[model samples]
Target: MKINMLAAGLLLIGVSLAAVNMYYYLEGTLSIQQVKMDSPLPVKVTEASSDKQWPLYDVKPSVGEKFAELYIPRLEQVFPIYEGTGTEVLRTGVGHYIRSALPGEENHTILSGHRDTVFRGLRHLKEDDELVVTTPEGAFTYKIYRIRIVTADDHSVMAPKPRATLTLTTCYPFYFLGNAPERYIISAKLINKQRVITWNPSR
Candidate 1:
């Protein structure tokens, strides 16, 4: 009788552990599916004349709202851009600095993401590579001019610019296990602007 009771208790514990593991496995799979589903689709674009004025965004996007997509020509990857830089927002996609100027505006436009996730390929980017941001208003193309490594607390990289500029930042040491001590910064200058006539149906 004692042997049977011990075996029964062990079997119950084993089943409970298996159940917990299955629940976590399913949760992780669903989270990945959610990120894939949230990714923004490519939009059609047309080059805007140099003399033409780009549309200005008067209303700000609400936090957690996806407003644009970042496309790296070299990597051939697209990452959705969310409004805020909160942990949850960065988990799934890039986050836009709320205080910075919008794509078409004449100031700094900053976008950041996790090194291991949405920006995993950012380390492969080189000078002169193009970064394109597509929004409902239009598509703005930027050419990488400078790449630098700065401390995590450095705020100089976020300084205002006179012309339209796009800044991409991610944690340095892409393979670091814990929090990174530095940041990788990519500075790009606007080279072209295009009007997005056809919007993404899912947006």
Candidate 2:
């Protein structure tokens, strides 16, 4: 009888251990699923509003996070705009300067991309070409007014602006084999802005 009792006790302990292991396994699976569901989705532009004032973005995007899409009408291409100018960020698409103003802001907004990648056709862009930056808050349209080639060390292109401005930078000599010695700069001024209304299915 004692042997039988011992066997029963061992069975109970084994069941309890199995239950605890199952509980933890299920919890871990749910946590991973929750994180996947919480990932941010691309913001879609629904409509354009005629509001005179540009919508202000109070919250800034984290580094390496994609917050906007740049549409170059002349190039007929759209590039995702990430928050930082790191190598990885530029490899995927355009990078926004963290210290500069964001789209629709009343200051300078700087964007950069690799010459051979996203900005390969930038050399073909001329004055009056439209560059549209669409963010969750709004869509800003800028007209290229000037194109300049400056030394790689030049920082004057980043000076403060009285009005909203967009500056695009890329390595000069579009087809250069190695690191280029000059910087190609495209200066554009905000000509129009439209507020974006994002639609959420949860709402």
Candidate 3:
């Protein structure tokens, strides 16, 4: 009886610790989301600049692969972005589509993020929302087209239906009490281009 009680106590303690850790992790993640995004460092991509080729070290297929900046204008916040191509980064911020490659790649360039942390503000997006991706090379603007929901395992949802598309995915049923079984997806398209104001790196 004493052994059974000890085991139960241990299990309870384990569960409690897990909850506490999750709580702290979520708090930190939200705090990060509140930070201003790192503004672009000045680099021009002129026809002349494109003439000079640079060596590619880490050949990432998607935009989120490298140190790129993403902005959801509606949110009024931009945070440091990390790659999300594999299972390792999926739990963090927007992930790139492994098969589709980087943003502006042929066909669809996909990205995924945690609805609650890195992408919690996504729920606030509306039609015609402006999503911007600023790379070391150039900045591309995408117009919000639609929002959708699919089953958790619905891989088809990420496939590009329209050419030159950008897909964003996250867990669905934002208010669910437990692990969600659905997925939320957002689709947008490249619309405008602009030269970002460059400045020296703060850090």
Candidate 4:
């Protein structure tokens, strides 16, 4: 009887620990939530775009630091983007793959997030859906052209592109109980670009 009781206690402890970890995984970005803009600013403000000289976009962030923000109109969600893909980095928000392009770099930019958290709404994204990505320098509009599920080993989805592209990735089967073997990918191409005035760095 004592052994059975001890086993039950251990099981309860394990479940409690798992719950704690899940909270951190899902709410990890809360600390950075204040940085999210109430709504993404419009890109065509003449004063901000007149000179076309953007210094904010050039602000180089240190490794694992906040680099940008993504605004999804479809999901009505804004998430902070951080540099580096380490566990600690992802805990705050989206992780920018170090090897990918930075905003306005005319190359591919790859971002990753947790399936249970920041990217949970991605499953609703459809082809042709438009989204905005804002940086200290400006705002960019991209239209999704492809949504696919690929094996985790797939690299072509994140491969270099001659033109500017944005890719958001998360574990597939959004509600899967454990680590999922497949990956969900949202691929978008830059359509409209604009330099904007934002209070991000200051706020």
- The runs of at least 3 residues in candidate 4 whose Cα sits more than 4 Å from the true structure, single-residue gaps closed, are 1-5, 29-59, 201-203
Model 2, residue 12: distance off in Å is 60
Top of the candidates by lDDT: 1
Location of the lowest summed lDDT over 10 successive residues in candidate 3: 48-57
In candidate 4, which residue pairs get closer than 3 Å at backbone N, Cα or C atoms, i.e. clash? 57-137
Question: Across residues 1-203, which tens digit of lDDT does each residue of candidate 3 receive?
Answer: 99999999999999999997697557536534333445443334332123212212245534344455566767765544456556445444556666664554446867777667777777888889988766554566789899888999888976665556777787888777667899888889877554434522111
lDDT of 1 by residue, 1-203 (tens): 99999999999999999997566444322322122433554677777766544566757789999888777867756667889899768766789998998876678999988776767678999999998788888888899999999999999999999899999999998889778999999999998888888867233
TM-score of each: 0.78, 0.73, 0.72, 0.82
lDDT of 2: 0.79
Deviation of model 1 at 175, angstroms = 1.3
lDDT of each: 0.80, 0.79, 0.63, 0.77
Clashing pairs in 1: none
By TM-score, how accurate is candidate 4? 0.82
